[model samples]
Target: MNERDLKKLKSKKKGKERRAAQKAERARLAAAQLLVNQANAQTDPLSKFPSFINYERNGLTSSLICKKVKELEPELLQWAMNLCKENMRPLYEKSNQGWHEDEKVEEMTEDAAWYLIVLDKAANKPLAFSHFRFDMDYGDEVLYCYELQLEESCRRKGLGRFMMQVLELMAFSNQMQKVVLTVFKHNPDGMNFFKKCRYDIDETSPVDSYEETFDYCILSKMNKMKPTQKTSL
Candidate 1:
């Protein structure tokens, strides 16, 4: 073929390849959306994992239950809120955002929010709780852990790690892309805890700039069983 004809052919082939890639991406994201929707519809994501319901080690015995915000009793919700404030208010007040009780309550009571609550079996009182949601983040389906607060008495025990493992199991079993959370930079203990659990700074986490630095960072643990393509930096 002549030079001009060859150039035209090459352009046409490139255009076709680009369109094909775009179509494939759309299909992939559609599948992700479907997975998230299915997960959100479940009344109890934890029900399927019977073994994870009970924590009976590290000298701390507790039972876990997962429920949507609407399903939670008023008193239980109040306790969770109180525990969150007890564990995090100081850290929140110290952060750039400061502590906003109203905003936090609103978020905790959102219709889509879910709670994985841990109760002390003997006393029948809550020891820890994690508020989370299955949603899309940065174009990927993720299990976003909003809060993982434990009562002071439960700290330093292995309950925190066990709860994290449960969250990971639920996230991956339901086909979520990953388990994501935000941790304050000032809370070294919190940051170190997640790091020990194998979480790393996610791609979407904000970076410090010369003008303004962030006080918090986003961390995530990707599902090794269902790997996704990562964009090159």
Candidate 2:
């Protein structure tokens, strides 16, 4: 073939390949969005796992309830917000972002927010809570755990880990690509706990550069039943 003809052929082949990749990405994202929608439609994701409703380990007995932010009682939602502030404000203040109470309140009350709350059965008080969402992140359906907070009295018990397990179960069962969370760099205990749960630094986690560094890191545990999500084209 002539030189110009060969160049044109090559260009056409590249364009075709690019178009094919774009089409495939669109399909993948559509599937992920469908899964996220189905998950969010549930009144209570925890209802599917009856055994997970109660946590009776490490000498702590608590009842677990999963509810959307809108379904939660005003007092309960307030308690969850207070616990989150109490646990996270110090870490946020220590980091570059500092602490913003108004912003935190807004996030906690968002319509998409879901809560997994642990209640002390006898005293009928909330002891711990996790705020999460079923949403598409980076083209994959993910259960993003925004906050996991426990009262000072309940920190050492196995409740936190059990809550994480519940999140994982719900995510994988609903065909989510992963259970994702962000932990502050300054919180060594949070880092260690996630590590113990077998979570790794997710591909989406930011890397430190000479010009800028991030105070928080994203961690994720993938659903082993499915192929891992592609991070790049």
Candidate 3:
């Protein structure tokens, strides 16, 4: 074949391959989304915790509820600890601490240590958990989130965003002025995720304090409330 014809044939082949790859990627994503939805549909009702909020996204369903860390079952608390170790090991290591070995279960069970757990009903498993409490921050009542960790398998799904949305709703329902959380500076992805969710650096953060030298970013999102309405809680 002439050089011109040969070149045209090669270009056509490349175009076909590129299209095939794109098609396969789309198919893979669609399948993943389907599995998530099926899992969500299988969630069981939380009759014990009538106040639990049920949310559905990407065909997956998760239940968000609050409980004192002490109230959690031993196995569930252990699951949470394992998740924290998996997600925060790098941050802890950066600060020269052995977080994995320090179970800290007693500290986690403090009266003020509350947990927000997202359970996958169909699989009867916890998909993610957040440790938080209502505390006075700069003279304002804010929900302070200590840890928000998801199972490794659940990371890329919309579960993080879904959990945060539920948390914010809970904050508003409880008359919290804002929701606040701290992210390690070493975890740029965590920082970026909070920012994308509309959380901004809190002016009250001790970013420049001399005594507190840990590399952390404190983020806050103000709650929207009606002037005349008050939360029953």
All candidates' lDDT scores? 0.92, 0.92, 0.70
TM-score of each: 0.94, 0.96, 0.67
| Per-residue lDDT of model 1, residues 13-94, tens digit only | 9999888788777877788889999999998999999999999987888899999999999999999999888889999999
- How do all the candidates rank in terms of lDDT, highest first? 1, 2, 3
Q: Write the per-residue lDDT of candidate 3 for residues 49-152, one digit (tens) a residue.
A: 35547756776677776676667788888898888877787677786344555555655667667777888878888989988776656545666788889887
What tens digits encode model 2's per-residue C-alpha lDDT throughout 32-109?
899999999999999999999998877777899999999999999999888888788899999998999999999999
Which residue pairs of candidate 1 clash? none
Model 2 steric clash pairs: none
Model 1: residues >4 Å from true position, as ranges?
229-233
Name model 2 segments beyond 4 Å from true: 229-232
lDDT of 1: 0.92
